[model samples]
Target: MADMSLGPGLGSSDTCRSAARQAGAPRVLLVIPCFNEEASIGGLLNEIAAIGRGYHTLVVDDGSSDATCTVASCRSPVARLAQNLGIGGAVQTGIKYAARQDFDFCIQIDGDGQHDPRAIEKLLDAYRSHPTNITIGSRFIDHSGFCSTPMRRAGIRLIVLALNGLFTGGRITDPTSGMRLLDRSAIAFFARSYPADFPEPISLAWAMRAGLTVSEVPVEMRARKAGVSSIDGIKSASYMIRVLGYILLARLVRAP
Candidate 1:
């Protein structure tokens, strides 16, 4: 079994020293964006640990009012935000920490156990082969995994249409996929200033517009094992509008 017993007080300081830093492997940090996902995170951590890929893990606990921090800290390094910084902020916190630690690559994963840790190798492999600044693990590239609902699928299609129109670089199939691989450039950029509330689609579109190489790899993602989605029901419509506006503005912005 993976050692799931990290000590308490990891979040006692501004910086936490909780990773093992195993040698002879690429310096990759798995940045998990967590809210009140106390129930699902432990299994995800264990799955990642079982991969034996020698990845350092950091759980960005976004001011959860539950046992999220406690449970996650026991398995990996925990960055406890004073308040909920939303998905973008929480993800950026982990990326910033990884950048400061000099990790060569950073991979973002959901804390709700939606993404399978086994496919992490596929993402890393695609990065190695293509060498893009960012590699999004796409569900629609192969039309596999949770394809989502009709309305949501149509929304994603519109967003992707905007992305392709905005950037000369090809197209992105799954614009809202949270599972992504970020190289040093992408990591450093996100560490400085990431998107706000709804980040995935906006960031991906913006990165392509900014002349950063972006690509996609095929990966299967599951439904969240626990907790409610932050973007569901009424929130999704608002998310669509916000991300669309961001993409339009990004396209008009200067490249580089």
Candidate 2:
């Protein structure tokens, strides 16, 4: 695990506004957490850069035994972990870095190329329009994107139902979506503590329990461009059962 020492604070509003003026906008960090995604990460980074958003990109290489680090480093700064931590750990690492660097917002994008970079604008627009701590890019809202398999969609629906019942703050249609944008407050909260098991749904529940507001917007997602998913076949069934149990447990526990 990376040592997470808090960096200098955000300082006064005047200073923050000055810095934003210098940078042309508030700093947004694109955190890509990957494991053995060398085949598609480079292209994904290129696509993000081509959008001319001027967002900083950080690739968290989750102890991949392959050349994922090298390939990612060619396009963006790579934070190579010493060992394989699950998706949750990798994402927490990126969030910690974002906190330490005093980024105004952090957006999590899967390295498998399943998330579309073009949808980033939609997420940003939602953030600007609403007072939300987290904005999730959902594929099920519009049903226009490349939704996951039938089995996975069914599992996600079950999880969403559970979350809606347990968390009355807001309705979540895509609890399993990895594509999400977190503001500074949300980033700091997640950096301090995050769910290690079933992070997607569990973290959403935990955030709501912590009194954070959540919202979702329609975004188009693509199928994976390369490499196989970590969960597939029989593993998908196990994933659903385990994630549902975790979400329930998360609801029972008080958020720290």
Strongest candidate by TM-score? 2
The CA lDDT of each predicted structure is 0.81, 0.86
What 10-residue stretch in candidate 1 is worst by lDDT?
A: 1-10
Model 2 residue 150 CA deviation (Å) reads 0.6
Candidate 1 backbone collisions, by pair: none
User: Candidate 1 at 42: error in angstroms?
Assistant: 0.8
The true-versus-predicted C-alpha distance at residue 252 of model 1, in Å, is 2.3
**Model 1 TM-score, 2 decimals:** 0.89
Q: Report the C-alpha lDDT of model 2 over 29-89, residue by residue, as the tens digit.
A: 8999999998999999999999998888888888888988888887788778788888999
Superposed Cα deviation of residue 227, candidate 1 (Å): 1.1
